[model samples]
Target: MILTTKSQFQSLIFTGTNGEYIAHYSHWSLRSVFQPIFGHNNILVGLEALVRIEDVHGESIRPDLFFSSTDISIKDKVNIDKLSRVIHIRNFAISEYKNLKLFLNILPSVSEYFALSDINTCLLSNRLKELQIDRSQIVMEIVELNANNEYLFVEAIKRLSQAGYCIAIDDFGACASTIERVKSIQPDIIKLDRGLLLEHFSGESNRLLEGIKMARALGAQIIVEGIETKEHLQAMETLDLDMFQGFYLATPQPILSCISNAV
Candidate 1:
């Protein structure tokens, strides 16, 4: 294992096959945020990006401490850069395992996606081809959607779909246009938000169920997020969700290690 024991929590930077860096931190005291989900039977699966901080005594820090910040610009830039690098890394890892799919988190603003000109695309595509990764398995998870520009979002989604890239509406059930955008864009994947699962009372269950059914009918797959327990997993099963992600499974780890272990 390339992991090192240092402070209470140790952070290791994993270099992607594409030369990007992903910093992974884990603490031995608890379930660190850097866990990767396994499909069916521990066959290395998707990873959830998470953060863990340590104190002087090496105890793992609480999640709230890290997320309570109010800096908008810093948050946005970090998200944009992180997603781009992760995708490049995944592209490199896929050379060895052609069946693996890469799920990348995307910001809502289309402008946030790094603009790829013809030249950029050519270079990147060449790199991916060398790694044996097809454009189809790369799924981009758009973090949020609203009713503001249903038509425009749908158009953007269609263009991406036409290019063989899969479109996923992340945090689906948290916004007003959940139904409208799903109907319009027809995303390949619809990810349920943790808020919906946490805040829903008796009255909201039926509506959530309807949303999932509507998405499925429109030819989109359903993936529930924020699952933290067996109860959440069982509830998702009751709802007939196709896939799920959250603490119940595993958190995101360095892509390099996940790839190495898969072999």
Candidate 2:
């Protein structure tokens, strides 16, 4: 999916429903985004969120670029109510289907800026109450917790968990940062990198498998990313992955619209 831009860096715009605009990428709309997953009962389920953007063909855009950017201006443009938008989306998703858990990501560093104030301390908690969704149903995917700020990262993890959100360490086995992240945050879920999944059963595969086991032993769920082919899906089966995501199962789709009928 392509980004729509008013600024030269159109990528930085995040348009929410009701014409709410935020210059920051954090909490970008996902009303057009869908999370395809095998439900607890092993059935294919889709948990849709608000704030998703559509591409030229009306397909949902992948959010990786939006969330993981290094540009400081992009980060600053995000609203302090970013987490509140997430909580609102989670509630909306649950209203449609009670079976699937709501998967949402958090910029731990960004969230700390808004959540630390005494007045807005219960922002997330109040949203949870209004949504009537269980904290266990919320999976907060955390990205980019590397060696530089171990103390702050740890504090972020502790705070989120204390606020009752399940944590998942995303992009594991993709970077050199894996083991250190595990030692520091101890996430409740470990999302295997798609690159390692491509190296299935090769020398790298063994290392990935070991990492998965370690996370599992720590009471973390294992999710394999980037399953695009039958072979990839089969390889994931061998690992008994707790969850799956990739082009094969279902690519990201616009939340308010249906999956593309082009195929």
Candidate 3:
């Protein structure tokens, strides 16, 4: 990716649209939407990058539908994943909240593929260098890490950690986001899935406290997502959690739009 001139860089399928950089693939346009990650002090500490997909008619498409659709092949899924990051990186570089941490997701298949390859995180590293973003400011979140090859997955996490990028295990308490995997990864942060919060509120389990304790004792920050109510925010604060995110704090919106208005 050695670039001698701006022309070469501009040829990456990103179109300049009304002060924003968007990636185009097939008949759909990919976008980066940010959900605020708030700290204990109720300050903006980071943003979780979420994807938005739209068809040629500009009609909104569910990300889950676009991402999990069997209508698309595995190769295109990986390409869309990469392009999602590209659009996010380019957009974040031009946003006002560039100083805060930008949490980018690593697709499960891509993570597994990268782990076995020599270019593990070179693409991300090169992109950040090209954009002049500090490696520490990027959070490499591995989704569905439980599905990846265990040995190579840990190796990939180690490689990224050694490269100065903070690692996070997304969706704790769901699927196979178990303690064994947590111990194996030992990520810098562990994001609790929203279901855990629901169970806690319903008094069905005390796993929430256990999760917080687990993350704390492991020397990792705990972030609880899906805090939609005032009680939700208060309860998290009472636990002295490290970070929080959900509709109560702010909804997911495009980074370019967030700068003009308070999120």
Give the distance in Å from residue 16's predicted Cα in candidate 3 to where it truly belongs.
4.0
Tens-digit per-residue lDDT, 1-263, candidate 1:
21112331113445535453434433212221233444444355554434344444777655333323354344433433343434444433634433666665544444223332231354334545666667676676666634224455556567667777777887887654377767767789887778767754334676567768788788888777787888877777766667777766764544444535532
Off by over 4 Å in 2: 1-32, 39-41, 45-63, 66-91, 114-121, 145-149, 201-203, 259-263
In model 1, the Cα lDDT at residue 219 comes to: 83
Model 3, 102-121: lDDT tens digits are 99988666666556555434
- TM-score of each predicted structure versus truth: 0.64, 0.71, 0.89
Better of 1 and 3 by lDDT: 3
- TM-score of candidate 2 against the unseen true structure: 0.71
Enumerate residue pairs that collide in model 1: 8-58, 35-251
Flag the better candidate by TM-score, 1 or 2: 2
All candidates in order of lDDT, best leading = 3, 2, 1
Ten residues in a row with the worst lDDT in model 1?
1-10
lDDT per residue (tens digit) for residues 1-263 in model 2: 11212232344435556333333434243343555666333466434233453444556544555444475343332442253355335434434454556666555555454334432244555556666767777777766543334566577666777767777877787653477777777788887888777676465678677877888789888887787887878877877778787778776654334443311
lDDT of 2: 0.58
